[model samples]
Target: MKIHLRSSLLCIGLLVLTACQSTSSPSQNNSAKPHEIAALFNQSTPEYKPETEANRTDKNIDSDITSDSKPIVYDDLWQEVIANLAFDIVPTPRLQKRIDWYLKQPDYLLKVNKRAKPYLFHITQKIKQKGLPMDMVLLPFVESDFRPKVHSSQSAVGIWQLMDSTAYHFGVTTDEWYDGRQDVLASTDAALDYLVYLYQRFNGDWLHALAAYNTGEGRVKKAIRQSKKQGKQGYFWQLKLPSETADYVPKLLALSYLLQAKHPKFKVPKLPNYALTSEVDFAQRFDFSVLASLTGVSKNQLHRLNPGYLQHQSAPEGPHKILLPLTEKQLWQSEFFQRYFSQTYTVVKNDTFYGLARRFNTSVNTLMALNNKQTTLLKVGEVLKIKKAQPLDNLMLEYQVSPYLAQEEKKPVLTMEHEYIIQNGDSLWEISKQFNVPVKDLLTWNNLKSSSLLKPGKKLVLHLPRPAKTPKKPEPKKFLSELEQLVKPNTSP
Candidate 1:
């Protein structure tokens, strides 16, 4: 059976925590296996409950910042936040320098203080729910800077930076509508669970566990073996590691330093702890406005709690959440759940099943089920039951393609093209020479004069030669750029 997490950030607050009783192994046996972490939880006779809540601080611990209403004094809390950032994971000088520079950036510090709490809270709660070390929540800062859309050079993505294979094993699907990697709450649970399992395998050594996170466990084991052969301790720092892993711990340490008391040393801002009231469940796709109308929450409040909704909408098939002030939970449950689906719309043009499905903040499969159809294409003039007018301006950001395409030989590769800014003293002539395009053709293509110098941030499109084609009849122009035609030289008729 498919386990669906609530996709919408609507009203419901259902956190699915299945206890594992250890059926078989996570190893493939021609049958789909439960995630290893889930399997482990299944093995326990009684579900394991973390003894302490992750984000709770002793009220008496320092009450320096007033209750939720008051803004935290940066100078007051920077020292504490930095001290709390200590981790055994990373330890490099270059990483230290990076953290220093990162903390010194005023804009970044402000964002960190303001936007990082929900992320911190989500991860910290997952850590506590799974009994993980609290320090691991800081990992996202290094991984994605708490940005949900971060895609790494190695194709690892999301805040926790899971690769496709690992994400699959951990139950994150890379489907058209959902990339579980970018789902902050889901990915945090998966990552923290993975971290705990790794920590157990490494005898609770966080260093080795972290190395497993950076480089796969198999490779880390190999490095440990080599370290032993060289009469070195099998510690992470001593083991031969990938360049990235070698720098990983250092980066963590640097991050810790930046969050430390010397925060002012880097002019770093202190982050305040955000208090969440409650998470309520909305079992169907609904618009943010509906949430506002139902729970008396403003649209801004809902988005603030659920920033992972990239298009400012929820996913389909009835698993959305609307985190609200605890006091509003009953108000939402009493009024919203029974009457939320009334603000519906009929399907219109440019509406694919998925597009309409997403527009309604529901799933394509759900729409198919709702309409009794199999394909994603919708019949023209088909009446779609939309929750709100379709969002015209903002769609999912087109996935970025690197210089190297992931798939082989797609047509019109320019769709993945990116722009390189022209720097000071750059000219179209120099650029064409650098990128190996003819100067006259480049000038004409970019609409530049012969004497015009390229300005910074100018967009240049590099056209790759297409396949050989039949020669066109010669035009009246003196000559065309060779790139315009792809034909073999003719020797004889």
Candidate 2:
């Protein structure tokens, strides 16, 4: 009787488990599973529809997260970034004074803070990467006020205020493709590295090193000597220094203090954390216009990301880089940089693939690639196609694309013509030797009939040769008779 009771109990337990499983996931039960049935029984479950799962997956697949659906402008991003920035840990007295100066200068103060906040955040992000202090970003405001194209009276430029020599020393290029001085990101890296060097050299006394940055180590040493002579304590402030150097560190500190004190008054924006996309080499000198034309991006867009470029074109300097927007870069990759660069023009009767290549300043091989054909054979009436001219690639030594005429690689003849403004103590002989042009040519070019008189701002065209066509119509024989008389006089004599 007891054995019969236990069998009945087992049967009852199996029935209960099956009931729970079906209750938990009735929609998921194509396969018979005991545990699944128990889970289904424990909770009220939403209907599991295969159609809904398929739809959800499809929705995720169709979504585009790389790019914004709507057009995004600087103003939209600027507002958020500026509102979130805060500066709170400055304590140097001179720095506080400088901060006071910044806060008081309404025109400079408000404009720089607003424009600089985003770039500062960018700097901070990079600093965080190297485990450095984020406050260093504020130093640029004192250096250049976040201006990308400012040239100092002392000859520093860009946001970091790097001198040309210093930039080159740091391996930053000053070619047509890029100017490290004006590039916000590159300049920041170089500046930070330089500062790190200075900090190490000066035993972490940032003030003395910063002063040395402006006035040089020799000047700083002189200041130290002067300070010791006067029996002063501490390093920079107690020492006598150049006015610019005296104020440099204080200026940095003041801005930091103001940001700390008035962070709420300051508007900081949030920048999206964008991963670097593609780093394709620009093996040729390329114009920013070409990138704009090819990528369907505006020149303005390129400028914002690449401020270091002094001009519209990039030096196809090997390793010339462009940090592209992720989605745009992806699109170009998908097309293998072919869509915009793949433009086609058909050959006319006068067309040889060589001629087409020359017209576009590309090679015959490149043209062949465009047409997907091998061999230079041409039919009298066979249609041929070619890529468009790309001058940007001209800067690259290896750029194979060229018009057939350009394949000959005509070396450029650089002719420099200068207009010499007569200065306080200058002479034609001196000017001719200085410019390496013949004195006779210089005088003739300028028509300097008077040997000694050159007024200031007088336009003197030098180094010009006489035209092959004619010499200034020789004082048109004002006298046909005089001319005859002068010729006949020789016979009379």
- Cand. 2 Cα-lDDT: 0.50
Candidate 2, position 15, lDDT = 27
Leading candidate by TM-score: 1
Each prediction's RMSD to truth: 20.0, 30.5
Q: Report the C-alpha lDDT of model 1 over 1-493, residue by residue, as the tens digit.
A: 0111111111011123323311121123222222334333222222112222111111111123233333223333344344333242232444556666665564665664455654554454454334333456668876666766555657676778877666655444554334566666767755765665565556445567788898888898899899889986565656778888877856665655455435554555544444334565555566665566656778677765654453344666523655664443354344443254334345567767666666656777766766667667666666654333233222122225434432422332111112346888887767778876788877665567788766676556444342233212233222112211212123586
Cα lDDT tens digits, model 2, 1-493, are 0000001111112323333211111112122233332222222222211321010000111123233333123333333222222222324444556655655564555566555643554565444333233346667766765767666656576778887656654445565435676767677766765554454444444566678777775678777778778875435557777787777866765554554455454343344443333334566556665666656667677766676664555654533566454444464444435533445454456567778777767898977876778787666656555554344444323335546534644432222234567776777777878877887887786666646586766657553321233111122233222223212322444
Q: Poorest 10 consecutive residues of model 2 by lDDT?
A: 1-10
Q: For each candidate, what TM-score against the reference?
A: 0.50, 0.47
After superposition, the stretches of candidate 2 with alpha carbons farther than 4 Å from their true spots are: 1-96, 105-110, 113-121, 262-284, 325-493
Clashes of 1: 36
Clashes of each: 36, 43
| lDDT score of residue 290 within candidate 1 | 52
